[model samples]
Target chain A: METFKHLVNILAHPTIMLTVGMLVFLFFFPPNDWFEKWNRRLRLNFLWTKKGFYFVMFLMVVFFLFGLTDPNFSLIIKKPDNVPIIGLIFFVFIFLWISMNQALKNDNLIEAGEKPEEYNDPEDKVLVWPDLVYIEFIALILCMSLLLIWSIGLEAPLEGPANPAESPNPSKAPWYFLGLQEMLVYFDPWLAGVVFPSLIILGLMAIPYLDTNPEGAGYYSYKQRRLAIPIYLFGWMILWVALIVIGTFLRGPNWNFFGPFEFWDLHKLVPLTNINLSEIIYIKWFNRGLPENILVREIFGFLIVFGYFLLLPPLLAKTAFKKLHQNLGNFKFGFFIFLLLCMLSLPIKMYLRWLFNLKYLIAIPEFFFNI
Target chain B: MSDKKKSNIFQRLGESQVWKSIIRSGIPRTRRQRMMSVLNSVFLHLHPVRLPRHAVKVKFTWCMGGLTFFLFLVLTITGILLMFYYRPTVEYAYTDMIDLGEQVPLGIMREIHRWGAHAMVITVWLHMFRVFMTGSYKPPREFNWVVGVILLTLTLLLSFTGYLLPWDQLAIWAVTVGSNMARATPFLGHEGPGAALLALGDINFVNIGSDVKFALLGGRFVGEAALLRFYVLHCIGLPFIVMILMAIHFWRIRKDGGISGPT
Candidate 1:
């Protein structure tokens, strides 16, 4: 029993004496350059590639450092109070163990002279890391640091412990969702969440279909490329930006981006008149002939606004499609017109509500439970 | 003659639609070919004939997105394990959460599930942004881009739905506000034009007048009904949809020539 206990201690102790011993022995011993030799024989460089291999190793070491420093055992241990130094140590060993295994596999492959195709550069293409990588990496690092400081240390004060009964006024969703939420404040719920999101999905899906020129595949797909599609997408993006700005800047006291902008209350921001553009388009044009007029009017407000926003894009898309066929002379012309129509329509849709007192378009919370 | 009579497995596999071409060729020529031919039969279908090797190389993958997927898988595993002990009833839900924190064997599982969810969201978003920035959403792979966007939405929805399962005050009201926000959805939302049509006799047919709150709760408001509805959506419905979409997304990757970017 004492002997077993000592063995266990040796195996599991912080020093990890036995494991390190095995690792050291494995790292140094049995120098098999067989794979390297095989590569030489085949002119393959099977276990070669100097910079790539080094970069991979650097990555492994970085991962190791992260494991050591942060030690993500909080999920397993539930001790958010203190960092798990022991878990970090164990994780490091585990990572090292995996690395060792990978190394051994590489060594064995070298010995067997088994060269994978990746070992041979097909084009001998000059591989350069794009300049954007560093910029993105820096941005990422900044964002991560901000989040860590906010969540872990003293940046934003943690709102007092979870209070179930009282929801903080204008209780916001996460920032990214703020854009979507802001859209909701303006439009109907379905349009904000489902239709708009769905349209975004469909738009993304349509990218392949719209941008057919293969020349724009790898790089420089952005320049003077087909007019309509980019315009449509860009317009969509602009709307999102506008919504985010409105969500953050222009919204009333309740869901305002910066706490309580007292320029106007919810009432003014919510245009509650009869003549919003979206309403006119929907009530007059889209739902023109539907009988049961009285029954429809109650929901007509919702229907007109919803139908115009929902259906107008496709109708305009059809017009764009028709123009694509009729005026084959200039693809860009058709595309730009389609984009213009969509661009004009949505803002007009938004403008009608904002300027013309289309408060009915703003689906109040009561509508949620009533429906 | 022997020198000229070469049979490199790597070369052959490296060759065009290697497995498909082999299968179409009737029989394997040798032992190595046979082994590879079998692997090619099963796994090759999951990928394209040739994946422009450097394209998917780790440098391009950036490991961050992959790490996020890894964490998601971990979260799924640990979440399932925790679910075995967690009862999603309003009364027991919060208690289960606390219990998991205090009593669950590893307790790390719960923490992992929690933190992993957060990490997965951040990673997936970054993945989308990376794809966008690289112009990876361009043609041939456009549909896949859409799939990715859907996947991102599903991830957010999953996180939102899961938020309520903790059954804490934060979960209840946050979701209340969130769903209320959903209630304002432009086209389909009840508050928009759709609400009147969705109702009948002062009872919402959509929710039987329950609305999204009622529909979500199986009652008029956020109570036990809401908890159960969110539980099912989070655990079963959304995940199922996501998994199906994810399968389609991955398969499309191979079909669309594997991560279109700077070659």
Candidate 2:
């Protein structure tokens, strides 16, 4: 009884202790030198690249950075309209980022004049009949049996008839769309629900067309198809999957934030004051009352967002991602960078909303548009 | 001599004209016979007549796409069985589900159908992921990937429409939330965009009654009209589209020269 109570108390209060521990450990650690030494010890000389060690260190930083939060654990990220479940997201993001970095390094090496690999017959293959078909059949049987067993153990969920009057608290979409739902916390309906989803589909469909790297065609070779594969994987693992994880577990009553272990309360009414960016700039900064026309007010916002996505790509091509730009050419580079930044803006906008109550950069209620 | 005359009945049947006509080629003695064995049967032809050894390797393919297709077949069979009992009405829908589960013959079929729908989505995702991981989306296979993406969209849409059928809170609210996302569709959505642009005094071009969500629901909100439309889409319309697309996807795979692997 005492131990159980003690465990519960630790769970409830472990937030501060963990934050302190992670911060202290990070402060003392010499990440660069450690990664350098790690390359030799692990002997990633044969297959994997030395970039992997650096990525591992980066993962540690990412892990600890999120760990030192207000929540009792790193997995829970509490905000008014979002509670990001970080566990799976963290793991997946780390995997993606590191794998990408490693692949990039390896590809760079290969590009700078190195042998692709040994001479082996690419067409060497066995018969597909009994080999593939029988395996598929067995897998089918196994899956069906497993599903049947699971069904027998746990029945499918069915709630009472829906009453429009008595709405469920913190009414959420299906688990898959939870990321978008989470995004709704920081973004307008048009941006979060419609624009981003469309963009994601478009981006996915456009991958093969946009990516010109022809090295890894019929196989999985990180070195050959470094840029394309890593970028796509990173987007998939971090942006979509992570957001869904966050939405599913951390979002509680009234879309208030809650830790994974925390219980949902119907009365957890957070007195949130979400202010539009235009409101702050106009009403507070300029000492103006309010604009009668939404379109006029949203003009500044429209320019800013459009300008950011469009202008920033060329600027990046000239500077930070110079190699990428050089490799992909002008059009592809601009397009790729635009998509990347747009995807990145979700998290940025989300954090801003949580930290500073930023509802929308551009709020045009008349047009039912917000950015 | 009498014993010799009385040959095995099975052997005699095997040699009989009735068996010969059906069997076509006797015991598949040659390579041509082996090919004929596959070609002659409608069921066997769904698979390739021959395969590269690499194609057979379980590690290479993971069989997720095949499993997803199989699950779709399962959903179709179970869903048809379920439809015999389920009545899509405000008063009857929920009760019909309950009746299907408890009072109807083989009540478990409904549960399987419900679970199978969920499984199909998951399998499709895994299959798509596998394709991406293998870098099979490059060049000649690029259009196939697009087809795959469309199939994926169709799968999600089908699931979304089906969510409202049970008339339970889970179904209704999920659909409501899902459909609400459509309301934000730029230009075409009622409240989204172009409403102000296209409006001419008393006539708003885009509205709750005319938009995608409205068409999807067949009303202002989820009601009887929505349920009927959803039922039609889930049972007939979406499935028909999905089947055609799937046929294209498979044929493209064959045309692309069997399955992709490390080369």
True contacts kept of each: 0.27, 0.58
What is the per-residue lDDT of model 2 for residues B1-263, given as tens digits with 9 covering 90 to 100?
Answer: 14474487865665678988997754454666666666776666667777655466554565779998999999999888888888888889998877877787645786677667767776777688768866788878899999999999899888778878888877777778778877778887887865557678988788778888898788888888999899999999999999999999998998886676434
Task: Give the per-residue lDDT of model 1 (tens digit) for B1-263.
Answer: 14353386644554438555646432444544443443456633443333344455543444455555555666678778988988988667877777766686645565556555666775675565445534567767777887887888889888888877777655666677677654454324455445666556886555335445445657655678778888889888898998899789888876787656444
Write the residue-wise lDDT of candidate 2 on A1-371 in tens digits.
34643453354332333334333322222123454355346554322334655666577576446454525443334321122133334434444343334344544555777532321355554333444556877999998896686556545666788676676876787666777887787776777888888888888888887777767665444645545654665566546675576566556778876654455667876787988888888887999977777767777788888888877887888887787788889888777887888887875675667577878888766677677
lDDT of 1: 0.51
Candidate number of the best lDDT = 2
Off by over 4 Å in 1: A1-165, A224-253, A257-371, B1-65, B102-111, B133-139, B181-213, B261-263
Superposed Cα RMSD, model 1? 19.3
Instruction: Give all TM-scores, in the order shown.
Output: 0.54, 0.80
**What DockQ results do all the predictions give, each relative to the true complex?**
0.17, 0.44
Best by the DockQ measure: 2
Q: Mind giving the per-residue lDDT tens digits that candidate 1 earns over A231-295?
A: 43344334543344344333334653221112233443533345533346556678764334433
Chain B TM-score, candidate 1?
Answer: 0.75
